[model samples]
Target chain A: MRLKCPANFRIVRLPCTGKIDVIHILRAFEKGADGVYVVGCMEGDCHFKSGNFRARKRVEQAAKILDKIGVGGERVKMFNLSSGEGPLFAQYSIEMDKKIKELGPNPVKVALQAKKKAA
Target chain B: MIIASKKPIEEIIQEVKDYKRLLILGCNECVTVCEAGGKKEVEVLASALRMHFIKEGNEKKIDEKTLERQCDHEYLEEIRGIVDNYDAILSLACGVGVQFTAEKYHSTPLIPGVNTCFLGANEQRGMWTERCQACGSCILARTGGICPISRCAKRVMNGPCGGSSKGKCEINKELDCAWQLIVDRLRDLGRLDDYEIVAPIKDWSTERAGGPRKVVREDVQV
Candidate 1:
């Protein structure tokens, strides 16, 4: 089925959100993702038992790390939803897209662009 | 193991912001297991620093290096060949490793990336509780393996101080009174009589009270 989400929304699926490490989120920001959000299984419903729980904690840590790096923690988020929640997934995508639009391009990318222009 | 927690990224950034070339040093032993100064942490911190500098429109040459164990002179010497390339070193080891690294490279600035918290056991993932204080004494055999020096709020040898109620320390209700734990353990081991014996005054001279100390074994000398 087609994902009814914004064209700019890029989805990288993980077998379980627990596989999403802090480095992954940090790298996304470093690689110019204006915003990054993890959609994990609903609380206590993870197929991998505690994958969602672990993912939530890692996301919280990644958000803090982002905040420390001057990126503002709001740029990274974690959401819990089951696999059957197709509409919710669409909603989250739209919500994240709007959030990024408000935040504008990632500051890191903006700086790189400015540097390129000057060169 | 030596427990540690990462320093606030904001504080770390502030400390090394002026340095263009910085090395993020990680330790592979205790810090790695504690999830503080491990190899993976080096990557996370380095990535965060690089991202921050990119956003600030500054050129930052952040490098990563993970030594087998930063507290050893042999491991620290491995960086000598490349130590001159960086303006600063961000050590993610325990405080011991940071000091040792600094001592080895006296001219280079070595900043601690983690706050060395305690000698403790990881109760579970992400949770650590102090287990030993290195008081230079081992009384576990007589104390039924419950250490008052480290677990006790007051470090009283004969205790369950008047302040202890319901097996908890009065200082903090959450803390289990060290004496209480010792009594229970001794009772379970059928050695309740041991609890009645008063422990002699500890020799504090062997502890930090004696100032910096060292052990040089002539038999082990090469």
Candidate 2:
């Protein structure tokens, strides 16, 4: 099945969602990613027994840290869908793109550009 | 092991805003086990601080390092060469590690990044419960290996105080009564008879009641 996601989004594949770490999510914002979302296997359907659950917890932790640093936790989210749900994957990506547009550019990225201009 | 928790980011930023060059130091021992002040935490904190400074349009240098153990002189020595490079150091160790590091480095200002909580055991990934108070006296033999001093809210030597009900402390229903646990343990060990023996008044001097305490073992000193 051929499906399309917004061009603004880039994908980083991993063996499993459990491979995601808080640092990986935070680094995205540091590198000026306007928003970040993790898509993992549906809850309880993880091939590794609980990898998806672990990924969700890490995602929640990342969101909390982002909120604490005033980066807007809502910019990060975790969604679960089965491997067969190709259409669902495309829909999620589009939804995320719309959400990021409403939030505008990450403040950290905007400040970085301003500093470069001043220099 | 000693358990600690990270301080709020706002509070930390307030304390270090005046400093230009800063180092976020982490301890790889107890703080590491508790997921508070460790190498991973150091990196996360460094990134967060850099972002905060950048978003505020302020220029600041933030560095990160994790030591084997900050409470030991030998481990503290590892950072000696770089200690002076920063205007201030943010230590993510427990209170003991923070003080020890401060003692070793005289000139640089030391800021604590985490609040040292207590001598505790991790119950699960993110749950730590206090276990010992280092009272300088060991009475676990008589209590059937359960400590009332740290576990009991009232610290009553002979108890299941009136505040205890259904094996839970009245202070918090979620908390198990220490004396209740002691009694249960004693019964299981066929030593319920020990429960009837009234304990002597504890010597409070051994605990923190006496100013700061110290231990000396000449044989252990090199």
Q: Name the candidate that leads on lDDT.
A: 2
Backbone clashes for every candidate come to 0, 0
lDDT of 2 at B216: 94
Q: Calculate the i-RMS of every candidate, to one decimal place.
A: 0.8, 0.8
Candidate 2 CAPRI category: high
Q: Pick the DockQ winner.
A: 1
Off by over 4 Å in 2: none
lDDT of 2 by residue, B1-222 (tens): 999999988999899888999999999999999999999999998998888888887768999999999988898999999988899999999999889999999888999999999999999989999999999898999999999999999899999899999999999999999999999999999999999999999998999998899999999999
Q: After superposition, how far is residue A22 of candidate 2 from its true place, in Å?
A: 0.9
lDDT of model 2 at residue A85? Answer: 94
Chain A TM-scores, candidates in order? 0.94, 0.96
Global lDDT scores for all candidate models: 0.91, 0.93
Best by TM-score: 2
Q: Taking the tens digit of each residue's C-alpha lDDT, what string does model 1 give over A12-51?
A: 9998999999999999988888999999989989888999
